[model samples]
Target: MNTQDPLSIGIVGLGNIGRYHAEQLTSLMGSFDIELSGGMDIAPTARDRFESSFGVPTYEDHEKLYETVDSVIITTPNRYHEEYAVSALESDINVLIEKPIAHTIESADRVATAAAASDGVCMIGFHNRFASPVQVLKQYQQQARFGDVHHIEAKYIRRRGVPGRGTWFTEEAASGGGALIDIGAHAIDLALYILDFPQVTEVSGVTRSIFGGRPDYTHLEMWGRSGEGPFNVDDSASAFIRCADGSTISLDVAWAANRPPNNEFVVQGNDAGARLDLSDGDLTIFESSSAGAPHFSDSEVRTRDDDPHRIEQQRFIQASRASEAPTVNTVEQALTVQRVMDATYRSNERGRAVKIDSEPLPTVD
Candidate 1:
């Protein structure tokens, strides 16, 4: 890794995640072997803040920022991800678009198309795929420790937590669905990836905005906004998913709920079961058998909280230099997650099991 090779990095969108990446770039200046060429944000105040904090060049125009950098990270809102990603890729700059590539499948397709048309690199930020616990689970599952996974149950419930009250997050069009699209998307991606991305057969679910207009719902404020703003999105969602191999996944997500637990998931198979609790930082496995007394067991390895985002960024850099495909590259792979999301929304609308397009979209070169 040569520091003088001008591996210039540009950051689009100066939100929390964007700022985190910017700080990472600043911290990795010595060892990571890269340059923070510049950064862009639509808000001038944000740009000013970024420049003041990091002493990096700031551009109000993203295009100008793109012209000066070799690679760009799109951390904008969901609606604008495709716009900035496509723009950067068209400029022959490698790009790493944040999760939920776009609000719509069509936009995700366009971003992939632009990347394929050019020789530039493009990858979606599915960071959890890089976490150590997740990687370990994947390895064990690959070794068939669970003896053929038959079912998975996941719950990402929070005790009264909802993001920026009146901001773009609560808006349906800008951020897509509320709870399901936000936290549920991560859970969905994790489960699907672990399941070897089983072919989704059918999806049925319901979504509700239990306290969208309730002023009393003030105990948990995710975005740190006041209650006067409209919260016209689903606060909770539940879905029943059927895989092509006859396996099932019971998924539930709630940004705000009066539950005793925070966030947890259980992956079960004939031979064993494992519990993953993000808040507690634990991934415990339970070995069992139908012939003996039901029991629990734990692997002797310690779980280290690996910084998934940093690992994801490093992988992008490696892939860019090596001209290799990332673990989760292709728009079609992303669409697999999107299909479940779309079906969930449709099922909520129709109150019935909706069929999914099992056939993946054409792969991009």
Candidate 2:
């Protein structure tokens, strides 16, 4: 493979996100020497729209796109993540699959196995890790700024924000689960990333579908194609996780809730604590000084204009060129997060804390 040659990138699943990926990739071509090979989407309307807008070829079959591109971005729903990702890897093509990896632990495991055996690069699109505040938090952890971390509280709640009431998001079979698997994947991955991907020992959780079946429920924004389908997934979820190192994490997420909208992660440590507001990308560090009288200090940390999705794509291309899997977005780390999510649902069903037996997979240096 010629490292200097421009990489050919293709996208699968031409939905809103897939189009956004195309836009970003198109914009990046000016800076990074790359080619927009083409795209694939099952929806005929979507394929037509994408081709007409981007002036790029669109394929009905993803295998045809895979045959042309050096790397592919898998942006299909959670259910199709594993199938497409595994196929791409098996074909010796690099892949960047969206979050959660797969809809089930079994599927995630198969994808992980394929990634471990493949020479091609595989990365999970946990783009939040590239956010400026999140990048700072990870740096703080590395610098030991948060001394001996004990607990992390993560919440990604939206008031009246149900995505496509009748779409695959509301269907358990298509989406895997509800709020936990959707937005909660972002929350859980961010928390675990900040904590350096701790091994979860146990998980206790509860899930509810209070708003999905409500036809009278009103919302400001509803995403996806709305119609009438199975609303058999949870709209809200809460969970408590215990890690092997004795640290813990409290997670709360919902697509629609009665409370005020909240998207933040608070890390509590012995020496200091920090809060990150995901909405505006602001980070606040809290510390107490014991001089004379105990005084508290709250300092807001400034962040750069970091576009995480763009950064994530650039890094993926770089990693593929180097023939190395990214440490932050590897299949191993995503498998750990997926296992935690699976345990949360199981714990909810069992009405007890579910013990986690899956260990964290290894990452390449």
Candidate 3:
């Protein structure tokens, strides 16, 4: 990228997510030297809306958009990720793909393989890691403030927030899994990230399709599927993950559950603990202080409220300009998250814990 010229950026899958990134990237044009080259989607209606809304040209195929942009954000459905991402990488175009890397382990493996062989960079969209609180907590962990961090209880629950019954989100073939892949993927990735992306040994999980199949399912809000569609996937999932460093993670994720939603993560360590509200950036640390006799202490960490999506977008463009594969959110790290998701589904089927082999992971050194 020339300093005199802006870094050309593009977006794929002009659905809700695609428009979201376009809006963010557009808002950032004045701050950073970047352009929203164009948008691409298979749907004509979506393309029309994107062009009118953003005033950028739209495409029905990724090939044309790929010819124009240096880097692209693939925010399409999980199944279509591999198609656009691999094509872009082969052309040496950087990609920032959305979470759950691909629809299945095999597809994710192919994407990762392409990233490895290509001269382009690919970063997974686990955008939650860019949140202010998460960054602060990670810094504390690096400082050894949370000594011997052992376990993380990650929860991303919704009392009744299903995307309705007949959408790509509820379709297993398109989405991989329901709540596990949709929201639980974030919980799993964030927990693994906080623990410095530990090596996993085993995973035991149970997936349930409680409310999604019900004809009279009650929900306060639905994100997609206006009327009714095919709902053949799990709506909730629970998993217990075992790590090689004697650390464990208890995961609870649901799109629709009977209990009230609790979107908080509890990080337990030998010396201290923390409770973070996933909705907001409120974080409180729990520790026992030795001053003035042993006693418990609580410290609230207040951080700036910046949009994680915008932050991630800026980082991707900057990193892509620096190296073919910038190490912020590596494809390997996302693959590990995919392995856990894959293992969770397997465990659900076999009714037993599944074992995973540890592998060396790439980092942002």
For candidate 2, what is the TM-score? 0.97
Whole-model alpha-carbon lDDT for candidate 2: 0.89
Q: For candidate 1, what is the TM-score?
A: 0.92
Q: Which scores greater on lDDT, model 1 or model 3?
A: 3
- Per-residue CA lDDT of model 3 for 12-119, tens digit only, reads 999888888899998998898888889899899999999899888989879999989889999988999999999998998889998978999889889988888777
User: Over the stretch 1-365, how does candidate 1's per-residue lDDT look in tens digits?
Assistant: 23357578889988777889888777766766677877899899889888888788988889889768888888887889888988887877788888787877677778777877766778888777787877778888899998888888878887777787667677877787688888888888788877888889899999999865476766633654554446778888899999999888899998887777557768898877787776666788888554577555666445777787877888877766655556564455677777788889899999899998755565556
Cand. 1 Cα-lDDT: 0.79
- TM-score for each model: 0.92, 0.97, 0.97
- Please estimate how well model 3 matches the true structure, expressed as its whole-model Cα lDDT: 0.89
Ordering by lDDT = 2, 3, 1
Q: Would you list the clashing residue pairs of candidate 2? A: none
Give all candidate RMSDs, comma-separated: 2.5, 1.4, 1.7
lDDT of each: 0.79, 0.89, 0.89
Candidate 1 vs candidate 3: the TM-score winner is: 3
**RMSD value for candidate 3:** 1.7
